[model samples]
Target: MAEAQKPDLGPDPSLLILDDDESFLRRLAKAMEKRGFAVDIAGSVADGKARVTTNPPAYAVIDLRLEDGNGLDVVEQLREARPDARIVVLTGYGAIATAVAAVKAGATDYLSKPADAGDVTNALLAMTEDMPPPPENPMSADRVRWEHIQRVYELCDRNVSETARRLNMHRRTLQRILAKRSPR
Candidate 1:
């Protein structure tokens, strides 16, 4: 005799995605939904905070920089509101200082920008005690330097002269490097 079909389990718990980049947020939300999470997307800190206050998700992916404010604020609120929620902070301007701050602020994990859906998912689901192995092929020295320079450039509010002065490099040189695409 044929066995009876099992009942379908509903989608997993809610997952909040906060990012200022419209395209990236939309894509990631769809991907997370496909992976069984019920996703809520927020493009700013205010929106994220309101959502969390209304109904905090079980998991969250928050961008370090938001249009209205820093993502750390959201992280702190989420921690206060939902201590059990797993929070992963994503940043294009990755730095040791900020990473420490994020973790201290209650982030379960921190990932640099360009993190794909799979990476975000893994980070969110990883057990607190289980640390994943480092990447086999880390970024090359040149790529690292480029990323650093770009990060500083952004922090300087995209002012080429200011970024150059902050980095102690010539403006022309900084411009040249910025003109080139990031090295593989």
Candidate 2:
């Protein structure tokens, strides 16, 4: 009998990750390198765009909020320049609206921050395949409100004071929103 052949599972061609958090970027790059990806890191949206333009990577992981600009611009550029590139958005802000926008803007996947290396790996894997299901709909007003709250809430790491401050509302109002979202 003939011997069976095994499929090859080699390192990916290349990957780029963009984020303002230097420590996180460095750690992520190292982890991905161990996983056999030739990784590049960019600290700002402009740098990310420039790198992509100069030499596009097979995969890109972007943060939705950047110090220089919103990460969506990078997403748009990637869509135009390298349509086959797999893109994933990692955000501290993950509201339904932004998630919807990310999908429409051509991101392959979206994940909340505090995401682990595995999350990043799975996201990359997901992007290489066809898109998965859209987020559920007929969203209740409360659900929508909750999603908004989560987006901003996570953006500020559930700090009522900071989230309220950023949202331009009284702390009490932000508290009330959270209270309403929480089940009795």
* Every candidate's lDDT: 0.88, 0.78
Ten-residue stretch with the least lDDT total in model 2: 1-10
Task: Tell me the tens digit of each residue's lDDT in model 1 across 18-40.
Answer: 99999999999998777778889
What tens-digit string does per-residue lDDT give for candidate 2 at 41-143? 9999999999989988878889999999999898899888888887889886556788899978998888766566667776676634565443333345565
- The alpha-carbon lDDT assigned to residue 32 of candidate 2 equals 76
Clashing pairs in 1: none
Task: Tell me the TM-score of each prediction against the true structure.
Answer: 0.84, 0.69
Prediction 1 TM-score vs. true: 0.84
Badly placed stretches (over 4 Å) of model 1 are 1-12, 133-140, 157-172
